[model samples]
Target chain A: MIRSIFIKETQLLLKDKGTYFWLFVLPILFIVMFSSIFGNAGTTTYTIRYFDADGTKESRQFMDTLAQIKGFELAADNEKSLADQIQAVRDGKQTSLLVIPQGYSQRLLGKGAAEVELHRDAAEDAAAAPVAAVLDSVTKQYQEHKLRVALKGTGQSQTGIDALLTAPIQVKDIKENVAKANPVTQIVPGYTVMFVFFIMITMIHNFLRDRDSGMVSRLKGTPLKAHQYLIGMWLPNMMVVLVQSTVLLTFGFIVYGLHLGDLFAVAAVIISLSICATGIGLMLSVLVNSVNTGVAIVQIIAMGGAIVGGLWFPYELLPKAVQWIGLFTPQYWAQRGMQDVMIRGAHLDGVWMTILILLAFGLAGLAVATASFNRFAAKAKN
Target chain B: MKHVLEVADVVKRYGSKTALDQVDVHVKEGSCFGLLGPNGAGKSTLMKLMTGILQADSGMIRAFGMDTRHQMSEIRQRVGYVPQEITLYEKLSAVQNLKFFGEMYGVNGAELKQRIAHVLEQVGLSDRANEAVETYSGGMKRRINLAAALLHQPQLIILDEPTVGIDPQSRNHIFEMIRGLKKEGLTLVYSTHYMEEVEALCDDIAIIDHGSVIAQGSLHEILEQHADQAVYVESDYITEPPQLSSIKRASARGRGWVLESEQPLHTLRDLSQLFAEAGARVHALELVKPSLDRVFLKLTGTALRD
Candidate 1:
């Protein structure tokens, strides 16, 4: 009977175009959209629109030096006056504007400071901060050069000058998971985990349809047991979620070159997540009285879990409290497990906690569904 | 004859409303037992109880000599229930729906396939078995709905308002199917509000109203016991009802008046003489047969359709 119901439900799902849209198509669309938007975050160039009022040799040299830095593209605004560019900044038309004032050469030659005016919108601080940091770095380099030249005039050796130039404290930067820390890694798994919960909606719909249409009552008259029916209805959805996740993850891999670290570990997470999602689906299918209520609850679970569980972004980036709460959601564990394997190069042993937590959640949901099965069946319209 | 089903004083209540109050019905083996009642008269409740879809508040329902409360699993294997609603999955093909139901009843493999084919042929939908039910007409869908229950070849088949909203051709097809099942010595419990349906198909019947069984017996016995005897007369000469001493009650029927009496023959004679004395032509005059409609009106004082 379970096999029969599974086959019937599978056929029904195949014929339903809405299941495809919600499970496969919509998740892939989200993955593609987010990947396209943020895939090249590391290489994205921040532009510095500037009016070189001084246009002198020194000002041009300064501008060229700043332009030499990577990820800081310089665009000379020769068409607009300095005042107009500053007004554009004030009016929020531009994030920031740079102006090379007159006497810029004299200040560098003299003992005075060579200053550049940077007019920026404070509201656009994130966009303007990198540009300011670039300018400050260039200023420090000039200062070091001045000091080196002065030491040369005092007849110090080159080795002594080099020793003096070294800073007392140095910051060393080390990149970890360099190959796996890309946007595709975040987005592919994030959307996949988020949409896995959407199977709840399909489950709710199928179960409620049976109840309201008198199918449940009719089936109750059969020799099929209640537990048999519940398991039969549940297994097909679990299989669907498995297939749905596989299709979505495969799309991520083929289209965006998403790295899946360990195939076995990924499979384990997929299996556990499928069980977890469909188990909750079974519980909600019997627990809710109406399809509208079930759908509303599904939205809260899928979308809300997506946000808090860090399926929409990196878990570390969320607020501390939300991160604490996200630990309670199976989606969080699933996403974390995927990232641990795909991003950190972990294997089955590393993701065991995730697998266990997900399985526990799935089992809990199944238990609840089992306990409520009789009441749910009783409510069916005879 | 052996009793296939026996319901003893079943009382079912939905909150404060009594859907079935001390309802009792019994079905003999190899018989078509009709549960006749108006809408909301608890025919469905009784049917559900017999199938174990519902538990009676206070009663003992034994099917095939097994208590429903304990031996439901065994009974379910022998009894097929066709719910009042068309409950087949519309998105699936007729063959697919039948296969699902067949397997649910523990029929499988080659046996399920063959049974599906048999039921499809029985319902006259063998050619359209592969098409989705949603694409079929209402009557065709109903045929498939009934076909689903027959997949298991149960000894007793319970049909709840199965012919409702069906075309005449499909209804005839269903009637033929019921008659065929009865020929095979299978017991059937058919519930409906249509008087003619009961009169045409049922050998034994129980008339229920307001959740109580008012009459139960063979077709002849119930009519002889509760149905009124009367004479229907139509005459152009007699403008008002003919005043006769033997006629007890006069009520308008189609184009005539049904005059009730202790002796329908005497009333008919008196009516004929009165019309003759008026020097008027008599269009029709005959003894009224005892009908389920008159029986219901006599028992409950409310029309069946009401």
Candidate 2:
């Protein structure tokens, strides 16, 4: 009986175009969109608009030095005066501007201070900070050149000047587990986990349709039992969630080259996550009174859970309070479990806690659904 | 005749309102038993109770010599119920829908496949079995709905308003299917408000009103027992109702007047002689045949639709 109902439901869902759009197409679109936007974040360039009041070779050389940096570009916009460019920054039209005063080249030749002014909007501090850092680094390099010339004048050897020019502290950066930690890692698994819960919407629709159409009452007259019907309806949705997850993750793998570490552990998380989602789906199917109400509840669970559970972004970037609350959702556990295997290179032993928590949620949902199923069946049209 | 179903003093209530009150009905084997009533007359409520979809507040229902409360599963295996609503997955094809229902009734394997083919042919939709139900016409959908209940071949089939809102062709097709089932010695409980349906298909019937069985017997018995005897008269000269000694009451009926009496033949004879003496132009003057419509009107004091 379970196999019969499972096959029937699978066939019905295959014919329903709406389920396909929700469970598969919508999530893949999100993955593709977000991955495209954030994939090249490390190499994105920021423009620093500047006016060189002194047209001498020294001022042009200063501009050339700043432009050589990888992510910062110098744009000479002479159409707006220095004052007007400053006003543009104040009006929030531009993030920042740079000015080289008239005596900059003379001051450098005369052994005096050469200063360049950087005017930026306070509200656009995040965008302006990087430009400010680059200017400061260029100033330090010029000071080093002056020091080298002064040391040579004092009769020191070139080797001593070079040793003195090195900074006292050296910051060496090391990257770990960065083989695949790109936007693809966040987007592919995030969207797959987020949209797997949408199976609840389809479950609610099928259950309520069965009740309202008198199918429940009609089936009650048959030899099929209540538990058989409940489990029969539930197994098909779980399988659908499994298929949806596989399609999305595979799309990420093929299109974005998302590295999947430990295939067995990833598959385990996928299986457990499917159980957790469809189990809650069963609970909601029996608890909700109408299809509209069921849809509302599912939206709250899927969308709200996605936001707090870090399915839209990395969990480390969320507010501390939200991160604490995220631990309570099944989505958080499922996503953490998948990332632990895919991003952290964790094996089954490392992710056993996640799997257990997810299964606990699924089993609890099944228990509630089993207890309330009689009331749900009783309300069917007879 | 052996009784296949027996319902004694079945009373069902929905909250404070009573839906069925002391309803008793018995169905003989191989006979078509019709439950006749207007809408909200408790015909569906009683049918649900018999199929074990609902439990009566206080009643004893036995099907195939098994008690409904304790042996409902056993009864469900032998009884087929076709609800008033067209309960089908419209997104699925007719063959798919039949396969699901056939398995639900515990028919499986090659037997289920054969039965699916048989029922599709029986409902006259064998050619369109692969088409989705949503694509079918209303009459075609109704045929498939009835066909779903016949896959398991239950001994007793209960149908609640199965022919409502159907085209003439589909209704005739269903009637023919029911007749064929009866010819094969299957008992059927058909519920409807149409009197002609009962007259044509049912051997025994129970007329229900306001949750009670006002009358129940063979089709001939109910009409003879409660239907009034009357003579209809139409004449140009006798405009007013004729004042006769034998007539009890008189009322207008179409272009004529129906005069109620204890002896309809005597009143017919009196009207004939009066028409002959006065030499009036009598158009229609005859003894009115007893009908369930008149029987329902006499018992409930309202039309079936009302």
CA-lDDT, candidates in order: 0.92, 0.92
lDDT string for model 1 (B106-203, tens) is 89899899989999889999999899999998889888899988988899999999999999989999999999999999999999999999988999
- Per prediction, fnat is 0.98, 0.91
A312-381 per-residue lDDT for model 2 (tens digits):
8789999999999899998899889988988889999989999999999888999999999999999998
lDDT by residue for model 2 over B1-306, one digit each (tens)? 899999999999999999999989999999999999999999999988889889999989999999999999999988989999999999899999999999998898999999999988888999999998999988889999999999898999999988999999999989999999999999999999998898899999999999999999998899889887999998897878999999998989898899999998899898899999988898999888888888898899998778
Judge candidate 1 at residue B187 and give its lDDT: 96
lDDT of 1 by residue, A1-382 (tens): 8899889988998999999999998998898888889988978999989888787999999989999998888987778877888888999999998888989989988889989988889999998999889988988989899999999999999999999999999999899999777999989999999999999999999999999998999988888889989988999899989999899889989998889999999999999999999999999999999999999999999999999999998999999999999999988999999999999999999999999999999999999999999999989987
Model 2 ranges with Cα > 4 A deviation: A155-168
> How far in Å is the alpha carbon of B57 misplaced in model 1?
1.6
In order, the interface RMSDs are 0.6, 0.7
Give the per-residue Cα lDDT of candidate 2 at B81: 91
What residue pairs clash in candidate 2, if any at all? Answer: none
Give the i-RMS of model 1 in Å.
0.6
